[model samples]
Target: MISSNTAQPMKDIYLPEPADVLKASPMTALEMFFEFRLASGRELGHMPGQFVEVSIPGIGEAPISISSSPTQKGSFQMVVRKVGNVSGAMHALSAGRQVGIRGPFGTHFPVDGEMKGKDILFICGGIGLVPVRSAINYVLDHRDDYGHVTILFGTKTPADRLFTDEMQRWASAKDVTFMETVDRGDDAWKGNVGVITTLIPKVRLDPARTVAVVCGPPIMYKFVILELDKVGLKADRMYVSLERHMKCGVGKCGHCQVNGLYACQDGAVFKYSDIASVREAI
Candidate 1:
């Protein structure tokens, strides 16, 4: 027998750790913000642009992106949209409620690596802002490590906006540029009114030194890429999140596979150039 005594037991990837809901609040009519702390009292230690699998005992499980940066220690945060069984169950939860958490799985943005010392342009649309917020806050926290920062956000209407207070803070930052837009304007709306792409042309950046991070609905990708191109952002210099395609937090299930790559395994975040040839990726 080949060193059977020295063999280690395989770890179960599907096993979930118990976590407590420290807080839950409404961000919009459809989304709820949740803060969770592991029962073991350790940090989630998730990277920006990564995700976790949230499980409710009887309702099933769902993959939710981590909305808080790792710099925010002790607990982690998620913005869950009440669109399905698990998320709907999560919205009904309150502080003290317990849930299961599987991972801080998948690849993340290059905040500490290639992105350092480079200008960053963040483009977020609708609920897509949830995942991108992690990276955004990380960049803001270490503002000195990066170059100029520009953040652009768009939603269907003013009523659909999330993190309003944070957006205002970002706008007020001395070195940051923040702009928001809506598809349609209302009586209460006083800002730009158009798709997110329209805001792209208004900003000035040195494309050679700038890296763009984009996340949004599937339909938004095609149009936004065109806009980024017009602004001279190269495909290799851009990254995008495809969190919507993630089903199983692990790659065992084929649900999240885009061509031959698994979104949950290979990435929910990918360099635009890496997946440009993968037909189903975008």
Candidate 2:
């Protein structure tokens, strides 16, 4: 329904359009980043947090988040963690390979709506940073539009981190406060050590006008929500992305159902107030 991307919108939700792989960079042993330019030669016109269904002609299809912002024109980015057959096939792609794309599906972070004029607190653990980074960078690109911003990142170990170069820039910047820690540290490590939730209480922010966006592993959600509440953030002020078994991204199937709602149709990005009633939604 949203079309900031100038490229052609999907003519058929079940039929995928061609998108070429311009580059593929390894982020970790299992995760890799791919930059795509639609065969239509149009921008993906995707919003932060929206996902696209990537199809490998003979292999199959998988849904991946748009890691880059529409603010960065021309193309979009996706970081895929290879945990199955489809993702493994994606990891095998090179610079010139072509893949099928179906969407910029589901709801997204409200970059132009509730997010405007508000301070932002981002909590990302491990691969969860993929979508969180999209919102963070959009706020950074238009720095003057928002108030104070804070970023907290957690990794399993010192060696498992992603985007080391950009991480350093965020750490050193005066405008944005960035904090990081690892679950376990080695002899070479000297920094905060513990769960991601440990870093949440130390930072102070104005919860009245702040929006906390969180994404990571499923288990991390409830604890993060508990911590955000401790900091005085109201239930409605917190937004979370729920991962589900996605099949029909357009809601025709009920694969990603939470409560009476379909995650694909109703939301994958929901206000805590909207989904708190569902015990499994966190």
List the lowest-lDDT window of 10 residues for candidate 1: 242-251
List, residue by residue over 1-282, the lDDT tens digit for candidate 1. 677687788989889999999999998999999999999998998999999999999998899999999999999999999999999999999999999999988999999887999999999999999999999999999999999999999999999999999998999997999999999999999999999999999999999999999999999998999999998989999999986556678888788988898999888999999999999988
* Best by the TM-score measure: 1
The residue-by-residue lDDT of candidate 2 on 64-163, one tens digit each, is 8888877898889999999977899999999998999988888988878888899888899898899777888888888888888899999999887888
Model 2 RMSD in angstroms? 5.1
Q: How many Å off is the CA of 41 in candidate 2?
A: 0.6
Candidate 1 wrong stretches, greater than 4 Å: 1-7
TM-score of 1: 0.97
Prediction RMSDs, each to the true structure:
2.1, 5.1
TM-score of each: 0.97, 0.94
